[model samples]
Every structure is written in structure tokens, then in C-alpha cells.
Target chain A: MIKRGYWDIDDILADEEPIMVQVTKTIKGAGFLNPESGELDLNEHTRFTIPLWLAENMATRELAKIELPKIFGESYLNILEADPRIISLKDRSNYFFEVATKLNDFLQDGKFITPLQKVFVARFVHLYNEITHNSDPKIIKKLTELERDIYEKGMKTTREFFDWRERKFDIIRSAQHVVNNAKRFKLK
Target chain B: MENEITLPESEFFAENTKITIIPNFKHAGFQILSGFYGPLRPSVAIEVPLWLGVFLKRQQKCRIIPPAWMDLQVLKDKFEEERKKEEFSELDFYYMEVSSLLLAHAKEDIPNHVLICRLIQDLQDLRTSKIRNSLQKITVENLYANFKDIASIELQAIRRLLPATYDSIDYMRKTENND
Candidate 1:
């Protein structure tokens, strides 16, 4: 899970600090293969990096409404068998980031986030996760710079933010600050 | 060398040699004491105006500290020191930082309702403290009042001073022109 600050609703919950949300590279199950024609029926599974935040009120009763039609509605109908809250945050802040659409109201409202903005969000998410989970400061400046870059670029999306995340995580275990913090939080 | 000095060597040397001694002494022993001057060099390096540093760091991704060796304890201490230095600067540079983050990442408008709501709530708490007229007290009211005022005024102005958006292509163009 990726949290950007203390105000995150999960900060108040049980072991919700470094909430784990696997941002894995998806596999499309099948890909086209052909040597002679050099053409096959395969689409690369899209990679996703989702920063799951906190549950708003922490009850399934209201989640059905808060996360329904507006958030994962159509998708909810299909994934309903899996439980909608699994992907949605039933919180008041209206946070939602599904990699495939990375286009929810959050990212599409603006022109587009620059690569720098993408990296910045990734850095901040990692920082917040760390502060929540580990309480480290070494990455604070990086987080601040990342935040500044995003503001300078207007804003970014979940996909753009995550695209930079996997890369930034690989580039700098800076995000590990959050992972480390998560450990500390769990110990407490 | 002593005999030459006794002979008064060159007139130019006689005059300049004495003057150069100060710098030499400084380079030798005095500079060591400078270390006690509060890690000023690192302070200055990190204290560089936020916008300028961010712009450069983004371009030279690997130029800043390699994340692997980043130390949070050190960073926290430094930030604490810097905050102490700027305690009376009339700007919540830090909170503006928070506002900036909300603006940059939220998938929606610049005002960012969630962050704005948070900001407004914080400000309201500060306003309550203002009404009490006891700013010296360490309370959320005082902290928020000062933080909110700083955010609305100084930070707002600074935000306006920066570009509303940046593009890698434009950055490349600027770099190419410099070369």
C-alpha cells in the first residue's frame, strides 16, 4: 500500500500503515507467436503499480454504496464475486487508482503529467509509506522535491505515478524507507 | 630559505609573504574549528532554494544522493535544524510543500478537495486559537493559524512564480540550447 501523508485514514487503523498492495506486472495469459509470418495473437499483460490507501469508515455496509456506481461500478459487476472493497477505498477522500484505466477523474482532469511528475508521485508515495511504516527522514527531501515537481507539472495519474514507481523503486530503494517504516509500525 | 628571508629577498615577496600567512594559517588549524560551525556546507547545499534544486535534481536523476545510502535520521536532524533557523520567517514552507504535493498528484483539479478540506479544517483550528489571542501556547490552533496564513500568502505567491507545468521536451530544448 502507498500512503502520502499522516492524514491518510489508514493511519488510525490496525496494521493499516504499510498496507501491502501488490503492484505486479500483469500477464496477459497468452501471446501470439510466429517465426515465418512474424505475427502472433498475444498482448503483453499490462504492468500495474497500485498504492492502496485506507478504508474510509471500515464497514462493508456503506462500502457497497461508496465504492459502487461511481468508482468500480461496471467493473464491480464483473468482479463482484471477489468483493468490491478489495480494490476500492471506502473513504471520504474519494481515492481510486486502477492501472488499466489510470484515467479515473483523478488523472484525466488535467492535460498530462510529465515524467518528472510521475517520478515525484512515486517518491512521495514511498516516503509517506515509509513515514507511516518506518519513520525515516533521509528521503524527506526527495519526497518534497517530488511533490514540488508534481505541482510544477500540474498533477499526475495513478498509472503515470506507478510507471515511475516500479522504475524508481528499482532505481533507488529510497522507497524502501517506507518498507522499513512498515516494519517498525508493525512492531509497535 | 631563512637566510634568503634574512636578506629581505624580493620587495614583492616581503610584502606579499606576510599577507599570505593568514590564508595558510586558516587552511592549517583554523579551518578545523570551522567544522564546529554547524555543518554549514551541507546545510547550504540542502538549503538551496527548493524550486532550483528540484529542477536540477529531476534532470540529473542520479546527481543527488543515491537512495541506497539515504539516512533518515540525518535528514530529520537537518530538517529540524533548518526549521529552527526559519521559525520566524512567516512562511510555512513545509506545509506549502504539502499543498504542492496535493496539487501535483491528485488526479483532479488544483484545489484538490481532499487536501483543501484538510487545509481548511486545519485553518479553522488555527482561527480558534487566534480568537483566544494566546499565540505563545503550543496548540494546534496556533500552529495551524500560522501555517495557514503562511500557506495563503507567501506560498501562494511562490507557487505563482513557478511554471504551471513542465514538459520533458521543453527541458530537452533548454538543455540543447545551452550546449
Candidate 2:
């Protein structure tokens, strides 16, 4: 029953730069081609950029290691630490929070979070706490408005992206179920 | 004081709703707050309530052919003409909602749907950027006054960005006052 707007996060993330990852083990699989660059072949110890969703899948399966770029490096942390203003951070990097969280999720199993991403997340958490728990009513109202914007726009996109992936997986599972049923019947 | 207070208009009108079904389907009549509507048939044009039209359109059961005033050409001309005039022209109250509804639901039915969507989005972006630019120089007294002409949905979109904008502006104002 939820009404989806055109500005959802899946659409936004689709337009964002793909995350770069290095192949730890050779992945000889069909449909692993970089859709944008049309590079189908992936070899061991080779580095390539893929969409965030795909990169997350590969990293989670131990097929690749995520390489956090320099923009998400210590230098970026220095800049954010100096300002610590929400607007300034938003202007500097629109996808920083999204990218950080995605990377954190992908690397959770291995505890592979980068030093800079760690710092940024900690800093953002502090700011978020202050904005939510502020004493001033006017400030609270304004901050709530801002938070609503972020949640509605950004979170919706994230939800839609994951939903599409889930639906795709559902189709695959159903097909596998049918195949398994067919094999069992053949044995009977 | 009466002149200064602009009355908010209702977002949708049920009486004026009409739609064309692209696919075949049947539905039993349903009761709504306004009245009863339905028994919809495929490939046939029917006049239903606005809520029914919207629901059917979202389900891809029908396409709401836009009103004459909501034509892409008409909107484009109006937008261009408004940009040329120093004074802003009064627009339909439901301009934002109607256009967005059509773009979202009846995309296949609308000729050049992509172009129309792009134009509407560009126009909205221009308006939002202008509002943001003005917000940079706004005072608390003039904040509501500045948004008097914007559509309700457009205003809703801008409200999200206002908190951060207001925060920065308020900070600057306080610092200047102190100085």
C-alpha cells in the first residue's frame, strides 16, 4: 500500500559510482560481467568495479575483497571532523553515509571495516544522537524535518533495492524447487 | 486580512474523474465515502470517482487520460511563458499532484511520457533551486510568505530541506546580531 516516488534510493544508488573490489579467488561464472563496462572475464587477484549490490554479494561470499577508496580515507575524515556540520557533509559527499553502511554490512563477517569508515560512522552516530535528543524545541522540530527527509528519500531507495534482489532470489529458488521435484519424480 | 489568507484547495475531484482500460478485467461495484463506483470493463472508457481511477491506474487495469489543461504542450507553454513574465502566473492547485499521478500511473498511455516527465521534473527542480536560493536570504518573518505560491506537494518536498537551511541561516543571523 506504500506509494513509491521516483526519487527512491534504488534509483539514486543505481546512478552512483560502483564500488571497487579485488577478486581474491577466480570467479568463472556466467552473468558476472560488469554490465556497464561489459567485462565478463574475472581472474584471481584482479581488481574491478561493480555495482554496490553485486559487490556486496561477491564480498560476502568470500569471492572478493572490498577496497575502500581514498575519498572514504583518513583525509576525508579530517575534513568532516573539522566541520561536523550536516549540511557541509551532505554537500561534500552525498553518498558517504550510504556507502559506509553498505561497506560495513558487507564486511561485518570478516571485521574488515576501514579506519576512516569507522570514524565517520562514529561521528555520524554522535551527530544523530544530538539531533534527536536536543533540548531546544525549534531545533528539534527542524532536525526532525531533516531526519524525515533523509529517511523517506534515502531509506526508501535502500528498501526498494533490497526488495528487487529478494524477488529475484525468490524466482531462482522456485525454479530450483521445480528442478529438484523433476529429478525426484524421475527416480520414482 | 481575508485577502492575505489564501484558502487551501482540495487535492482531487471525484466528479470529474475518467479513465480508459488497457487490459480486460471485471470488478463488482464498491462503496466509497462519496458514493458507489465501479463495475469496470476492459478497453472501455468510463467515468469513475477520482479514488477509483487512481486505484485502477496503479493496478494497471486502466489509464487515466489527462484533462485538456494537463497536456504536455500546454504545461510547456505555460512554464515558458511564466519564465518570461516578471510576475508569476497563478497555476492550477492540483498541478503537482495530477502531473505526478499521470507520470506514475498512466505512463504507457501518455504520448511522449518520458519527455513530459523530464519537463515536469526540470520545472520542479528549477522551482526548488529558486526556493533554496531565496532561503539563503530569508528571515523568520518572511519564511511562510515566501512559500505562499508553491503547490502543497512541492512545499512538502521543500520542507525536508528547510530544517538544514534554516539552521545555517539562523546560525548566521544570531552571529551577526551578536557582532
Candidate 3:
């Protein structure tokens, strides 16, 4: 019943991130999804990269099987387990958490379920501290799109509360959408 | 998910908290939508919502009586209690909004308002640190967080973060049957 990400731009983009899968059943006229393939039909038992959403659908229909991305492998997770605060996970994928979770849903072995949870919690705590005692704005560079969304929300509330305490609420600010609208329709 | 109350909205709700004020001018009472407010008698103390009290205080028609916890002694003790306790000691749910409104308009009514402000800031900082420190105990297995005495404003602070986390975790844990 949950209708998530129907209009979420980040969710849409996360669905577009590439995933590698091996074809079990050859598909005709699907090779254009990967232009480098150049073939008219996708060949069987050969590996190729495709958008995650296509891979998920193909995977569920027994057309292909997902190969774990290098970043989602045991070693990478171990590095995160050692100290999630140290590494910038955004390097692996901007939508690391979202893509990983969606991929996990396809995993029949459920290998990613526990480690993904552990990684998330660890990163979440680190993100929590940084938000409260934030000295650096560049910290967003390290966060995934998901964490960045959470961070922006937390930072907004923190700033609002501080403004309230200092009685510096400048109520004359225009909403971002209004500003964007005016920019779009500005007179020459 | 869209239910988190913003600062202005929370403040508007906090306006409903009752406080005592002594009227210098005569007024029968108010019959506004929320409820009926005091039948004001000159020099006689009457209880009314903070919004009405602040309104009357602004026009110099009434002297606002600072809430019990607004005193220096009470705040100092509260600051100490917050510093010493891991669990949040009880505070008025609308403490932040109420105090800000009072200090902004009715500063002359409160004795040692300066020190009280300082103490409130300290208390807020202590509780904020407490909330942050509790993050260490959170893990995949034990996300059983008890935010018992956290105020609305403070909850508003974490509302976006913790719920998003819970949602992501739920997404990752999605079972085969759910689809």
C-alpha cells in the first residue's frame, strides 16, 4: 500500500543508477539500453550493465541475475564496519542506500539485509553528531543522497531553533519555489 | 510523514498554555474560539492563555506573572538536574516558546531575567547534548529509543532524521511476501 517515490526526484535518479547482471534468457531489441553493446539483441550468459530498475524487473522474471557491485561486497562492508565515519560513501554511488536497499529486495539469499542495517546505523550516528556540532559545510560531500536529505532537514530545524532563541527571525524571506517561479517568468 | 510542526506552528500552539496576569484595566472576558478567558478585575490575578497575557502585557493593561519555572532558583536547579541526569528531567512541553514570548515582551515583569535567560540557554544545550549522546547506543538490533521527556521543539529537531532512518531500514528489511 506504500506509494513511495512516486514523484521523488532523488528516488527516480536512484532507480537510474547502473547495476551489472548476467543474462540467462536472450532479449531481442534491448541492447540499446547499453549502446556500447551495438548488437541488435542481448546475448545469453554474458554480463552487461543496465539501469537498476530494468535489471530488477529482468531479474524477477528470471531473465538475469544481479552481480553484487564491488562496493557492496564483503570487503567494502568490512571497511565501513571498521569505521563508517572515516570514509566518504558517496564515492560508491550518490544513491548508495536507496540503490542498495532496492537491490537487497532482489537478493534471495538476503545477504545484504543485516550488514546494510549495521552500516546505516553506524553512518547515521556519525551524521547525527556532525549535524549537531557541525563546523564544516562540506560534510554533505560524504553523505549519500538519502543521508543528505536527512541532513538538510536536521540542519534546517537546528537553524530555525537557533534563530528563534536569538530572536532573529527575518520573516521577509520568500519561499524557494516562489523565487524559482519569478526567475522562470522574469521580464526581459 | 508531513506532520512535523514548524516553529511558528508550535509557538501558536504554545500560546494556549495558561499563565496568570493582573489586569490594570476593566474587561468582562473574552469568548474566542479556543475558550472563554478571564473576567478581568483591576489588580485581581486571573488565568489566561499566554497569547492573551502577552497581548495585554504589550498594551500595559496587565502585569504578567512569570511562570513558576521561570524563576532563577528553579531554572538553576533545573540546569543542574539536566547536567547531572542522563534522562531528561520533566520540563513544560511548551517551555521554549513560552519563555521566548515572555522575555521578548514582558522582560520587566521577571526578576533576574538575564540570569534566567542564561540558565535556559544552558538547559537547552545540556538536553541537546543528551539527545546527541544517546546516538551511541543505537544499533541495528537495539533501536529501542525512549525519548520520554523530550519537548515538542526538540522532537521537531529529530523528527525528520529518525523517521527517515526508520523508513530506510524498513525498506532494506522488506520481505519477499510483502511485494
Candidate 4:
């Protein structure tokens, strides 16, 4: 199967988290007021946690600046450096790409990327290129094996999700097309 | 330089799976992954793999006849039955993908393309409505249960709305807990 570099929107939506941000300008929240929190009353330079979805909106309007948490800081780079497996790298690449694209879209002029985010993005791009272009036979074989393992796991989960035997059979037959495409990859 | 793989559209279907084709010209046979497929003769029906069928169909060399299960009457019946149930009826895992492929790429070959399209749309609308309704009433445990029945394509279609729906549900539950 031909692998394409694309992000799954469903996966992104499912993975959103609350993130801390420093308010750049005092702004009263409109529809986004969390009823439990009463109302969003922000003052310039104050830091607070907001859901990432909401943060995207606020950041776009220049109301706040994202504060990279510990997870997305030096620790992420350490994790990638420790185990640069294709699977893990692919996951990190997807995550960083999604986050970066979202933030870049919203970021105004004069705002700059955090030092850690820049390092993470640079490392991710370097690793992504290495894996995509590597000609080593052993690495290619391992990548192929990992692809097969992912397909099998996906199919198994899909099967367990459905209740009817006939439905399971039908899904397997249809999903075979996807599995076949993934299995037929040729390293360039 | 790293080269990203680009997939041809037909890669969405299982390769080497047999499909019926009606040819319009005479030509020499060719070999493929599974085996060889024929030199063509006009008006003759032959079984060939999905890849060859797609290739021939694209070149306008032959017309592809869809599988038996893809019949308009069968699909209509299934759609009607599924519409009535709170849960979706058992269907081929590839039913959505294959039907879409036929509709998009081989419309002329389907005798009742209009009817087929309408039935599929109605069924999809019903499913989407059911899912939306359930989303409003969801609990954490039931959220996972509801997701199991959603097709990948359906999930893609609804991805934009899901985060907000999930957040509202989570907020409501938390408020209830406090109360």
C-alpha cells in the first residue's frame, strides 16, 4: 500500500488537551465562558490553562501566547533521541506537525516559536527524512514488519468492535484492500 | 532526498480480486501479480482481477460489471431495513468504500446509478442523525460503545463536530456531578 503523509482529523480532535497560556491582552471571553469557572476574566501577563481547542481561537486573535508544557519541552526531545524507531517517530511527527500547523496559522507577526519547539521541529524533520530515504536493508525490513503489525492490530480492533459474524467477514474483506496497499510499499 | 509515496486511486480496492468486464476491442493478453489477463474481444464477458478491470475500464477498453451484492435492489432493501433499526444492519466492511468507488468511477456501468445514489444518501443521513442524537445523550462508557459502529468514512465526515460535542458532554457530566 502507498503510504501518504496526512493527518487524521479524528485522531487530532480526539487528542486535544487543556494547555497553559499567558494572556497578552486583557479580554473578556464571549461564548467560551466555562460555566463552572463562572466567566473568563483575563488580565495581561496572567497565565491560565485553557482547552487546546479554545487556545487555538484565543491565540489566533492575539489574546494569548502558548506556554509549552513540560511534556512538549525538553522531555519530548529526550524521548525521541532515546528511541528513534520509525513507529514512534511517525507518531511524534504527526503530533508535532498538527500542533505546529495549528499554532503557526494563529500566530501573529513578531511572535516567535519557543526554543524547545524549534529544536523539536528540527529534530522531527531530520528524523523523518532519514527514515523516508534510508537505504539500509535491515531498516527497510523492520519498517515493513512494523507496517504489517499496525495493519494486523487495526484489523483485530475493528473486528472486535463489530458484533455480527457476517459483518466481521465483510469488514475483513473490504479492509484487505487497505492492508494490501500498506504491504506493497517499495523503498525509493 | 526523501520521496513520499503517492498512491493511485484504484489502490483502494483489493488487487487480483476478480471482476467481470465487457470488452469493446481486440488486444493481446498481459501479465500481473496474480497471473495473466486476456487479449480482449468485443462483447465478451471475462473475469479479471480488480486492478486489470480498473485499468481496462479507465482506458475505455471495457465496461466493468459490478459484483452481485452491489445490485441496486439488494442495496435498497438493505438500506430500507437498516433505516428502521436503531442499530445498523450487518454489511460488508467494504460496502461503503466499494459502493463509493463504483459510483464515482464506474457510474455508466451501474444500471440504476440514480436510485443507488439516492438510497445510499438516505441511509447515510439516517446513520448520521442517529449518531448525532446519541452524542447528545452520551455517557463516557457509551461513547466508546457508540464509536465501534461508526465507519471510517463517517468518522472522517464528523471529525470537525466531535470535539465540541465531546467537550459539551464532558462539561455537562461534570456539572451534574457537582450538583
Give lDDT tens digits, candidate 1, residues A1-188: 22334564432331232221221222232222212323342222322222223212211222211122223344433442243212223231222222111222222322222222333233333332343233433433332222333333222222222333233322334455699999999999
All models, DockQ values?
A: 0.03, 0.01, 0.55, 0.02
User: What is residue A123's positional error in candidate 1, in angstroms?
Assistant: 13
Q: Estimate, for each residue in B51-109, the C-alpha lDDT of model 1 and write its tens digit.
A: 32233344432122211111334334434443454232232333333333323333142
Q: How well is candidate 4 docked (DockQ)?
A: 0.02
Candidate 4 residue lDDT tens string, A1-188: 11113485533552375577887887766414434445566567777777777787777788888876544455665664455344333333334333433443344311222332333323323322333233243433333222333333333333332322122332335456677777787432
Which 10-residue window of candidate 4 chain B scores lowest in summed lDDT? B1-10
lDDT of 3 by residue, A1-188 (tens): 11246797887888899999999988888787657779888889879888998889988899998898888888888888888876898989998877776776667556655787788888888888888886498989988878888888888888878887777652667877899999989964
Kindly report which residue stretches of model 1 are placed more than 4 angstroms away from their true locations once superposed: A1-71, A74-129, A132-188, B1-22, B25-179
Among these predicted structures, which one has the highest lDDT?
A: 3
Candidates ranked by DockQ, best first?
A: 3, 1, 4, 2
lDDT of each: 0.29, 0.52, 0.83, 0.53
Top of the candidates by DockQ: 3
Model 2, runs deviating above 4 Å: A1-188, B1-29, B38-45, B58-63, B85-88, B140-145, B160-179
Q: After superposition, how far is residue A89 of candidate 2 from its true place, in Å?
A: 15
Candidate 2: Cα lDDT at A54: 77
Q: Candidate 3 — number of clashing residue pairs?
A: 0
TM-score of chain A of 1: 0.18
True contacts kept of 3: 0.58
Please identify model 3 stretches exceeding 4 Å from their true place. Answer: A1-6, A28-34, A170-188, B1-3, B176-179
Looking at model 3 chain A, report the run of 10 residues with the lowest lDDT sum: A1-10
Ranked by lDDT, the better of candidates 2 and 3 is 3
